[model samples]
Target: MALPASSFPTLLFFLFLISHPRCEAAESFSHYCSYNRPTTPAISKSIAKVLSALVSKNPPKRLNTVSFGGGKSKVFGLAQCHRDINATECKSCIEDATAQLPHLCPGQADAGAWFDHCFVAYDHERVPEQHGTGF
Candidate 1:
């Protein structure tokens, strides 16, 4: 038997939904890693510290900046989630971004990743201000 005309639109809508999946918060969009490699073990340690801090902090407003160590060994990091997403999603996205950065940009002095719901970056120097610039 043939389906009624009333069900055609509903069926098409479902098909479209299935064909075009929504972007997940943890889905990676793009990434960048600086050409400058870490010159000392201290900087590498700092990078790990800052990245760990970023994941542990879990900003309530969905944006955070973290720093570790001092002087030449200093490492700075920034994590920001899209305002549309909730805090839990923001946290999860940040976690994923942090986990991927080390593998995505190994030994680099600065690296960044952009995901569907958030952005994460770290550098030996201070990370650039991400506020009020429309990212």
Candidate 2:
């Protein structure tokens, strides 16, 4: 059986907020956790915390981004907490999404997720276009 996908407009806001890669910086109005491996242990830990909450079913519903180590060209990701999700629920959804990505993508280093809604993947391509977001 196949699962259906959903989109949260909040994600667009998340994307809009993004600029360069500032793994160390965070915003109060948003919840962004990133893992910058090969350096920045603090960042990795921050990311882990968010991931843990996500899988546990307590997602922030504002989990806007999940970026991997940029040094790994094939590694990068983006996930949005469900708009309707409360902080706790959003965390949970993202955790599940994060865990499944590696297995689902297998070998592919780059993957993006639409929490409780969609998951997009690409390697040599930019972020995958969301439904009706246009390709």
Candidate 3:
């Protein structure tokens, strides 16, 4: 069947829409989880608690760091959500990161993970405070 020229533009538009695949938002991009030997059960638990708290307290796409427990059991945690995403996305990403990291690096004393929407790290030893600009 022959179609009128006026319908050509509409047909072209529809073809463009269907032919182009929708660019899906990524659930995760890449991750880095340390492979250090397992820590004491107390320290592991503390680290888990800190990570849970971080995801629960998702800020306005802001970076947050906290330390909990004490002595050898102390765990320092850091979480940062991509500023470009909304609060909801930020929270979701952080939650996923926190939940998966522990299992991904079981019994590890230091671990870090990065997703498309957020980044998280938990460790028994805190990074040393840099005295000068040397890296």
Reference-based TM-score of each model: 0.74, 0.41, 0.70
Q: Which runs in model 3 stand beyond 4 Å of their true positions?
A: 1-28, 127-135
Residue 105 lDDT (model 2): 41
Clashing pairs in 3: 38-107
lDDT values for all models: 0.82, 0.40, 0.75
* Best of the two (1, 3) by TM-score: 1
Q: How well is each residue in 1-135 modelled by candidate 1, as lDDT tens digits?
A: 999999999999999999888964365678887876653799889888988999998768677888989999998999888888888888898889898888888888788888878888888877845634244
Worst 10 residues of 2 by lDDT: 25-34
lDDT, model 1? 0.82
Error of 2 at 119 (Å): 4.8
The lDDT leader among the candidates is: 1
- The candidate scoring highest on TM-score is 1
What does candidate 2 score on TM? Answer: 0.41
The C-alpha stretches of model 1 lying farther than 4 A from their native spots are 1-25, 129-135
